[model samples]
Target: MKFKALTLGILIASAGASQAATVNEVFNGKMLGTNQRYFESIAGVPRDSFRNDHTFVVQNCQITATIGDGKVTALRLDLGQGCEANLQSFIGEDAPKPGQTITPGVFGSGQRYTASCLAECGNAADPSAYALWQAPRSAGGMEVLMEMVLAGDKAMTAADEWEKQIKQAAGMDYVLATKFNCETRFNSIAEAVFKDVPVNAITVGYGLPTQRCN
Candidate 1:
């Protein structure tokens, strides 16, 4: 009986480690949930004939997540290319309702706006995670933003700016296409990045979004 118990414990621990190992490989030891941010500016012709040229300033330019207690709890990454179909899987939580206005500046004061279900992904639970569509409500490249926390840490906080920027740009947001849930967000992240990352390596989540100029 003792031997059996010992063997089972070993197997369980090994399996747990194996799961995180996949997610761990990508960072190569840098740290999973750090707040280090990346962003870029993408310019484009106006989607509307009368509108000015557009500038999409994407942030956390690369997919990155927060790690806590050796698990990936949160995520931040672009939602396009091979990353599109799987947006919901990573959500790990329910998504917000479509047309839900994720007002900016919870602590500070700004009225920037970003619309979720602006396209589609899954049922949102967290209220912050989003999968956006393209111009005229097509599949604009997608992206995911989540929260993170270490074990024993208090509740996690989102990295997004609270002040409103979008509406301030003289525009309100609406979902052009689909809505999403947490799992869908998770799956999408799984599809977006370098494949070697082990599953469940992240513990907490965090997110900061980019701005668009049109």
Candidate 2:
């Protein structure tokens, strides 16, 4: 009986270790620069493949890998709304929730705005509320981009209210609006815009240098 119990404990420990290893390989950017053969070995054959891009489902997250020169150059994990729990578990207790202003260096070595231009200067596709993490070279040189969705009716209502206020303050001139500034406006009402918002997607890119968001 004692021997059986000891063996069972060993088996359980081994299983847990194996699971952790797999999770690290999949989620920690270890596979970022690996070749296709190595990627398949860890992630198994992808459910879908198109040219250099391969898509796989791991831990309920849809991950897409883009290959270049026979090595994975980029990875994107889409958690969607349903995988919030999974994301929380993976990112830990400090993970940013919708409407909360994410602190710098929370998800990567550095954090920055997601848009290429300031809020009003950018086109409709520009994301108003999102964070970017560019990891150091020692940490795989991958860019981690996380984006959030607003919290239903309340978020919309808050946005409408802000727009009204902005119009009042900045008037009808686009040039006047520049004085409001993206960072300043974002800092003022980040909580209202992103309150309880869950991250729906994360994209990781390897060999990508950090560029100034002009």
Candidate 3:
């Protein structure tokens, strides 16, 4: 039950109510990794000033688990600016140049990285999400594909286990209240929580054009 095509097929195939249920599972169950130090440091930094640390500066990350056919097919770990920068190094670029931005995303910091463990979630032909996140082909870079295959019974528990690790390593709370869904799941979570579709459209999930580590 991998998510070979990241499209709306599941939403159309499954009943609205069922798709909604799956969305709720993904929303409420998804855990957010915290960034205690980042928030703490944010308070200290001046409102207009910026800090430069060629490493992951943020203190939190998030996970979204989409269930299909009675199993978790996709588990996307949305990295914070800091996390994204940290991982930039692994793909290729590890440091920031004279005028380039490195306080956020770059390869070497290892701050942000997406690990797609399952083969059924993104492109079945390509089982790893790492490829999708990798540098573009034109840049002579690899693509980071979505990999979410490690969510079986025992492995599924890893999501919960990560909460404890987050607390211990980062000394922060991991209670999450927000989730991003395309439509089926998005509408479902909104209906379950607010009893309707989300309006006012405040962007709270991933894929922003800009970000910061600290």
Poorest lDDT segment (10 consecutive residues) of candidate 3: 195-204
Which regions in candidate 1 have their CA more than 4 angstroms from the true location? Answer: 1-62, 91-214
Runs off by more than 4 Å, candidate 3: 1-111, 114-139, 149-151, 175-214
Error of 2 at 115 (Å): 6.4
lDDT of 3 by residue, 137-191 (tens): 5433433322222333433343334333434444442212111111122222212
User: Distance (Å) between predicted and true CA of 21, model 3?
Assistant: 34
* Model 2 worst lDDT run, 10 consecutive residues: 83-92
Error of 2 at 67 (Å): 1.8
Name the lDDT of candidate 2.
0.53
**Global lDDT of each candidate:** 0.27, 0.53, 0.27
Model 3 earns a TM-score of 0.21
Candidate 1 vs candidate 3, TM-score winner: 3
> TM-scores for all candidates?
0.20, 0.51, 0.21
| Candidate 3 lDDT (Cα, 0 to 1) | 0.27
Give the per-residue lDDT digits (tens) of candidate 2, residues 3-32. Answer: 999999867765564455343356544566
TM-score of 1: 0.20
